[model samples]
Target chain A: MEFPKHLKYSREHEWVKVEGNVAQVGITDYAQSELGDVVYVELPEVGTDVEANNTFGVVESVKAVSDLFAPVTGSIAEVNPQLEEEPELVNSDPYEDGWMIKIEMNDPSELNDLLDVDEYKTFVEEESK
Target chain B: MAEPGDALRRTSLYETHVAAGAKMVPFAGFEMPVQYTGVIEEHHAVRQAAGLFDVSHMGEFEARGPGAAAFLRRLVTNDVSRLEVGRVMYCTMCREDGGIIDDLTVYRLADERYMAVVNASNIGKDWAWMAARKGAGVEFRDVSSETGLLALQGPRAEAVLAGLLPGGGDLGAIPYYGAQERTWQGKRVLVSRTGYTGEDGFELYCGAPDAPALWEALMARGGGEGLKPCGLGARDTLRTEMKFALYGNDIDEATNPLEAGLGWVVKFQAGEFIGREALLGIKERGLSRKLVGFEMVDRGIPRHGAPILAGGRNAGVVTSGTMSPTLGKAIGIGYVPLTHAAEGCEIAVEIRDKARAARVVETPFYRREKA
Candidate 1:
């Protein structure tokens, strides 16, 4: 599973790429791989307020439906509309085109609590073992 | 997420699944393959070409003796006498209260021999139920462990099978829901022109020892046509698109066939049966709830057990749902008040905290190519 060195990941398998006050969030490659062939994505509506670690959306794969938790507290700025048509992007390019939502980080400091790429990799490997 | 010593049972082809990079999951007490290659790809392959499925986890029971037909006729809802030798019929086993015991396919091998293929999880329960109703001269044998079953399904399934077996070109004329004894790789096999997926396909039943070889042989022959080893994930989605009733999810002991929309299979005129009286009364009293299909209008998926609502009141729960690989839309099957069972009835399904708008639609979200 690819965990980009620049991004931050949550225990729930969501990843965040923060740029100043705006942050782009999506599920990790590890998450998409485990979920398998995502069929539907429920993204938080734009301008919706979301709390860190709280469920803001859901991802439905062929096998099961899973909650997509917010990695950091923020007001949703934009949600990926493309996911409504092609949820498999979460499986194909989870970190880039599959980005679920943009959020105006309410407490950017919360990003520190998220795992870095190296730490996230170790965490996933240990979990798998 | 391996659980140590979970004791999940293994099918004869369990090792083969693992070798194919299958994602194994605990299902009905067996370590079964949930996916191989992927769900969507396998699902598409089954729609366009042939896909092989290792369905050995399904249970098979043999009922033989002079009274076999009479015994099964009373046990299941279908009119077993209607089946000729070498034919199969789908039926539902109902409790005395008219609730579903399990959905099964009955295969008549001869005048005095029959085979009932049941869901794996309901084997013990169904066995006990059949034993209690067993009368003199009928013998029931639990052959689930010794038998291996595989499904070869798709538009080109017959072509693929004919390419592998000598004189197999006639398999295309077997007719849907027909079964016959055949020889494959020196083993006597039972090839049935029946399947759970809504596709023209054949189900092969053979000894457990021959399952791996058969699967490998078919896969090798079908490789040129984009045939993939499908797992239960694709199988579930494929069957769901056809609105096929699954045992635990769609019909359970707590729900009767009448409410599950299987009343047509219950032959009340065929004389007395185990649940005949209750089911006949249900037919007279009218159904209060009925299983219906629905499509999500708003964003979100309606998962199994998700509450279904009509005018903000609880109407039912989703029994099965998926983004149909064929339809490219979220579709599900659920039970609702009989008043709301008509096609085009607007409804909503609660997914998480949001209620997604949906409309009751006609069943069989997908259709197979005509034979």
Candidate 2:
């Protein structure tokens, strides 16, 4: 699992990369590995308001379906349209091309409540145990 | 995750599975591998080449005596009397009310000896049902714990398995649904040309202690041929693509064989069986709900328990579903009203609160060419 220090992580196994008022959201590497082979990704519509820690979408693998929670409160500015055709990108490159949605942050301060790389790593370790 | 304190049972190949980096999960009381490498990779391996699977968790029972054939004939919906020695017949065991007890395969080992392989989850229940129906001259034995089964499936299955037999017996002599005794590592084993996946495959049955060795030997010999070790996940997807009815998902005690589109297995000419009267009545009354195969005409994937809609009204529910790796389309089996079960009928599957458009289609969605 690669946890980049520059990004913020959520306990739900999602990572957030914030720049100015816009933030990019995607599942962490740990999440994709746990999900095995992702076959479909159901994304929220663009411009949909999502609250922090609330479910905004669903990620379906071959065996199970999992909820994708929002890391911070915002409206979805854009959804990666490429996921519609190739959901495996979420498994291949979860942090880059697999980025799910872009959100225009409603409260940028909400990012502080999210875990840093070190904190997220500790959380993952504890959960696995 | 397999916790040490959990009461999950382990199969004979548990250590082998662990050594191979399998992800173990509790399934039907056994800690079984849900995946080894990945579902898609393992699935394609079975389709294009061959895949090995440890299906030891499934239950097996033997009936032997002078009246074994007679005793067994009254249990299943299929005509077991028609089953010749060295052949197998797929059938459903049902309660008197026409509710299915379990879908099983009956293998005629001899004129006076037979075996019934049942779903692991229904082992205890099915055993009790059979035992209660036991007669004076037949004997019953639960051989599930002592026996292990492995499925070697796909296009290249014969080539791979033929390498394991010492004298290199002509495996082609075993026709589909045929079973014969063979020697493996000096131990007599039963090899059946039957599988849930619609592929050219053989199911090998042996003593529990011989399972790991058999698995290891086959893997070592077939590794170069791309014979990957598959798990229940791939087994499920492959069977779903073939439209094979799973016991719990597709045909449970509440769902009769007729309603599940297994009427072919119900032979009225075979005389009285457990569910004969009820099934005959059902046939006379016609079907209200029928299980039909459908493909998503829209974007979303249909999942188990998803409500099916006909003309925007609640119709039925999805029983087994998956995004088929081979077909590359979202496909599912569900019980819809007879009116909506017709092929090419437009329907909607409620997926994650959204009604996705779909259409009823012909079953056995994926079939391999006869070699």
Candidate 3:
């Protein structure tokens, strides 16, 4: 439920840390806790083109498999390689070491559509209730 | 939506499970614990050492009267007449077409007294089936709600149970598939030297009120050896390691016992019984498809209902699969063409629109150390 003030979040619980045209993407802490004990993470290859609000990868837990949707339109610049051996990083450090991809933003204006920390916190609280 | 009457159906250890921070889920019409601590941790504990399981949700029925043996022989697939006064035998309740109703264990307590321990989900259906077919001199009674069952299983289970009881004698004399009545804490309890996990263990049955005391006693005595309270999650994984057939997943009314690799339990030579004719006919002919075990060679885990492929063609579907805690690899069971059921036969499972390489391996995937 910790929504850092520096990052922007999507309705699907993904977070993006913006820096110029380059942005780092990963699921939020709330997403990892809800999923519980991530066993496998399927990440898209670097340089792959991703559309906003489209599924780009998969995350599997012991109970079920879930689709990871792209929060913004971008071209993947880098993929986290450490997840191949340790998927639990998504649960332990979702915002830092567990970042899924680094993307070159196709349209920086799309950032306006994402929610801020306070708004994202309210969204999750209302959804849970 | 939750119903008001749901609270009425609770196991004897319901309060204890909730107190231990267990995740409660509705299973077989009762509130049951699905996990405690976590599924993976509890599963590994049972595989390496001892684990206690509250199986009180399982149904127990009694068949008593002068003709109890004859009556059970007609209902179940195994030969009940061969069981002695204090022994147990595994059997299957088959339909008229040789399809399985449920797999159960029959314990012959006396000349005219017998106990049938069945799956929790099949309690109502099985009870009605037996009651409708009550023949002359046979009587049936449902004693499920009053019985409390606990299973203490793994490599060090015998030592823990023996230490809890008085005299602390060696239980090594109890052979596999054996049962005897014993006293624990001045209370009469039936202890069975059997378990779903392929381990040296005992399953204890006592009155509902005595279950809490027995569980506490065993936990206290087994504290040092990594003995933990396991939930349904661990129980499922433990059974799958031994290639044990679960009723709803592996066999059902649509699948016959012959096709499910349970033909050995059907005693066709013994006199007439329900589903006997169909099973005999199946034996004379041959099965078109048979259940086989497979291990994934790729990274993906195969799951139930996933399509199986052989030689790049759709061959069958997986009935059960999991990332085996003991094997440290993905394993599954599926029904494939009879010709392709041999050991080491290559196959593939379609997981998430991708075909993962797999190989048909010999079961069981795991075996416990002999005592």
Candidate 4:
């Protein structure tokens, strides 16, 4: 379970890495581990507008189907092309190559409401119990 | 995630499963492991090497009497009278109206002694149905609670079972769907060359108390050879890949044999059975809808209850479906109108309100080559 100190995480088990007005989004390490061996990933188009806390995509493991929620209000800037051919990257390297999308934020201040490295770790611990 | 709750029954190997880091889930009224390691990994192990499955939650009923063969013949859709000693027969026990009660396998231990293994969840219902139709000369006993079953499946299953035998006994004598009794570790055990997975495998029926030790022994002997302890998740995917009909999902009380692609099991000439007459009627009237295997032409995963569409109208429903771990493609089994049930027919499965392109295909999507 690796959580980079600079990224923000959502209660829905997604992580956000913000740079300027763009934010890269991917599921957290805890999230990918819980969902064993991802078989398929469904994401929105690059220009699609996604609201915060709303479902923007679906990730299907062999035994379950999980919804991916947007951590902040944004429009899709980019989507990972590698995931189409290699969905298992979500299980192997969830933080880096497995990133789902990049969003151009509508309200960058929304990042304040998200959890930091320490806060997200604590939140995950409570959720697991 | 829903908790299994304290009321769910536990199998004898419960402690061992927890120790092995299995993800436990509620299944068939028991706290059963849904997976260990992962479903795909465990699935490939079963197809490539060997996999051990603790199917002790399945039910077993013993019938012994002067009329045991005749009684069982009348109880199921298959011809039980032709089941010689040491052989096994697969069939469905249906009601008089031809609704399936349960699908089970009958093992003929002797000329007048047999065992019917049923689905774990249907034990009570199946038992009552049989007992109500019990005759004066037939005696039925529910031995489900006292029996533990383990399926050793894959290419290396033969070597694994032969290693555990008392004195290096070869399994060549036990043909497919054949059973042999042996005193294993001083306990009476029946080793049957039968399995639901599309692999050459064997099932071991032993005392319930002996499950944990037996599981440990097989794991220790076969683990080094790539035999992993699999769970219900792997069991499901393996059977689904073979297109084996599940009792609740594919064939239920409302589904009959002829339309479910099990007409061969319903042998009217094999003598009297509960649903023989109704099945004959169904055959005469012709099938309106039939079960067919399909492959997704699009990227969506078709699931059970997904509405099937064909010729721009509602056709039928998906009975069983999944992303095939071996085929690397999404495969599903569902009922479609007879006009759209052919091997090359074009159909669409509506997944999450959007129709996805799919085409009917031949069944048993993945068959293991004889090794």
Best by lDDT: 2
lDDT digits (tens) for residues A18-129 of candidate 3: 9889878999998887766677788888889999999989887665688998888999999999987788799889999998988898998998999999999999999877
Top candidate when judged by DockQ against the true structure: 2
List, residue by residue over B206-310, the lDDT tens digit for candidate 3. Answer: 998888888888888999988999888778878887889987888888888888888878888888789999988888898988998999998787778999998
DockQ of each: 0.86, 0.89, 0.39, 0.74
What are the per-residue Cα lDDT tens digits for candidate 2 across A16-73? Answer: 9998999899999999999999999999899899999999999999989999999999
Show pairs that collide, candidate 1.
Answer: none
Q: Candidate 3 lDDT (Cα, whole model)?
A: 0.86
- Model 3 clash count equals 0
Tell me the whole-model lDDT of each prediction, alpha carbons only.
Answer: 0.90, 0.93, 0.86, 0.91
Ranking by DockQ: 2, 1, 4, 3
Task: Please report how far candidate 4 places residue A117 from its true position, in Å.
Answer: 2.4
Candidate 1 residues lying further than 4 Å off, grouped into runs, are B1-6
Candidate 2 local lDDT, B30-116, one digit each (tens): 989989999999999999999999999999999999878878889999999989999999999999999999999999998889999
Q: Which tens-of-lDDT digit does each residue in B184-291 have in candidate 1?
A: 768988989999899999999999989999999998999997789999999999999999999889989889988898888889888767889998898899988899
Error of 4 at B223 (Å): 2.4
Point out where model 4 deviates above 4 Å.
B1-6
> Candidate 4: global Cα-lDDT?
0.91
The alpha-carbon deviation from the true structure for residue B326 of candidate 3, after best TM-score superposition, in angstroms, is 1.6
Query: What does candidate 4's lDDT look like per residue over B215-294, in tens digits?
Result: 99899889778899999888989999999999889999889988899887888997889988888888888999998999
lDDT of 1: 0.90
For candidate 3, what is the TM-score?
Answer: 0.92
**Candidate 2 CAPRI category:** high
